[model samples]
Target: MTTIEELLPDDLLETLRGRAAGYDEDNRFFTEDLEDLKAARYLTMLVPEEFGGHGLTLRQASQAQRRLAQAAPATALGINMHHVIMGMAYTLWRRGDHRLDWVFEDAVKGEIFAFGISEAGNDAVLFDSVSTATPSGDGGYTISGTKIFTSLSPVWTRLVVHARHEDQLVFGFLDRDADGIEIINDWDTLGMRASQSCTTKLHEVVMRPERVGTHTPLGPNPDPLVWGIFGAFELLLAAVYTGIGERAVNLAVEIVGKRRSHVKNAPYAHDPDIRWQIASAGILMDGVVLQLEKLTGDVDLVGTGEEPQYGGKWFLHFSGVKGRATEAAKEAVELAVRTTGGSQYFRRSELQRLYRDVVAGLYHPSDNESLHASYAKALLGPVRE
Candidate 1:
């Protein structure tokens, strides 16, 4: 069967670009744009075959994300949270009751599945999620705690919250309207404004055991190759940042061609210094993209199941790629700003949003300091410099 990536027609790509182009003017894209992704079945790429999904490999899925980001970074970010959350469902596929054909079919049919894993008072790492679930008379349990930065939560129908039970870290699907849950005010962030990564409160919510996945612990993901919990998150954020850089470079190329340099008596594109800076950024993204592509291939080959550190080298690859990509995208966009000057920063300008979006990646989970420490730990075998 043809994969969902193959099904993404050229028209959809162009429409995404148009939507992204609009973001600079007025951050118009929001959770609703995720509906576009659902309609396109972009969110169902990882559902297993028995669930009637395309079951794409990671590399193919990464390329799909790359293409979507290339069109509109804002829309890409919004839709992708749902996409990634659904994709991660594959990791939980083997643990739960696979017979719940609706979760699979509805997901493939474009249902928006948002993941909630980060908690405000917790360790801030994947394994550090401190939300808890306790036994109830029913086969399910009572889940209570506050989850923060639930990307795409503002509009999702169902949210998957991860919490620790006695021995197993469980995954529970909570309806947005479910009792005991409240979406606090909107997320006011320096970047990714359209992502809707808001804080959510869950007061003693009831959940069924059938709706939760068992054995996935509350702390560090048991996987070795992907750093278990943090790898996928880092990889996606890096790819997104890198994609924004790609857009900036392309914009710079288009702008320089038509605009004349006020000082040099020629187009700025002809200036040696500007040309070199642009080329340098382009080259860095080129290298980053190659690494991202390779990493995707590695992930596909490695699969999602837990293994060992040496067996998978998970922490090492994710940290390096994520750190490199975020930095590369940020530096490139900054340089593009230099290449374009004051004109690109205006409200009417395209580069304005590109610049904001690209820099946002810098603070994501794989930022320089956090990533460096992770890699250092991998090398020195503990959390060390």
Candidate 2:
């Protein structure tokens, strides 16, 4: 029964909020925020209690991530990469797939995990990889390719990556200190600047037999590992953006209550148009909240030995939730910006930073086009050849 309040107290959140602007301005990693979260053991929230973690369910973890995002989206997103890997491992283990048991054990020992799946020009996503996984004579693989958007680059001890091994997609873990691995310090971005998601080049980096995890076919398939990854990644990503929307709505209410409309001789909160904008944002957020809750709750049930009957609809649920939440967040932030008046246009304003951060959601997996296509295919079969 670990509460989000206890894990991220008001004082800690305030400290993170206060530092957010500075980190954005300097484009540096949230080192202090990471230290604070580590002290609270936030990184191990998905690990079981026996492994020295909080043993939180996916629903609880999503709620905690939403709370954290309210204070600092970049920090929440940076730590989110670690949580995604842990969540996948936890989900698989809960379903009696102990292939990733070492993930939980290593996390308890304080080894941070990072994602290294995204690549340049790899539109096939998890189904295919631009990187190569050449089999070694010793039953391992030598990976060589560039991985973009490698979050937690500054602190991760282990990196989970994927590459193509002929007709199969190979997934494995690599130690940060492994030879032939190079981290490029080029992560300058429009928003989520504090994540430091730099580019990592693997020059035939060796992954021992024990390090390799799962290998699947070249295209989409119903592998449990794939299910675990999609479920954890989409849900957690939605949680973070939904948090941004929540923060935006709160800021709008606070700002409207304080600012007065001279023409109306009253606070902006009393103005019908301003009130309508805030209310509209709230209405949209209400649906987003419900969607997140329902989806996360369903995933949690799977941990208790409940069989998921989603079938192909699981992808629809996963991508649909993320797509809706992110787009709604952008609209909510826009409403907040419009309601807050000219001051929010300043670079120093929190609303301005949120405006920048929210856009990054558009580029994440299951982009709008892909999401819509998935939904269409689900509803009315795939496009005929």
Please tell me which predicted candidate would have the highest TM-score against the true structure.
Answer: 2
Best candidate, lDDT: 2
Error of 2 at 74 (Å): 0.1
RMSD for each of the candidates: 3.6, 1.1
lDDT of 2 at 260: 94
Sequence-dependent TM-score of model 2: 0.98
For candidate 2, the per-residue lDDT at 139 reads 78
How would you encode candidate 1's per-residue C-alpha lDDT over 1-385 as one tens digit per residue?
5554565777877766666544444544354456666676667776666677777765676667767777777666766666565545543443342434456676765566676777765644555457778878677877888887777765777777777777666666776666898888767665677776778888888776677544465445654311423555666666677788887888888888778987788998898888999998899889999999887666655433542334435666777888898888888888888888788877667677777777767656655776676667666777435
**What is the TM-score of each predicted model, taking all chains together?**
0.86, 0.98
Candidate 1 off by > 4 Å? 1-6, 21-32, 48-50, 91-103, 165-168, 216-229, 303-312, 383-385
**Clashing residue pairs in candidate 2, if any?**
none
lDDT of 2: 0.92
Task: Give lDDT per model, in order.
Answer: 0.69, 0.92
Q: Write the per-residue lDDT of candidate 2 for residues 8-57, one digit (tens) a residue.
A: 99999999999999999999999999999999999999998977789998
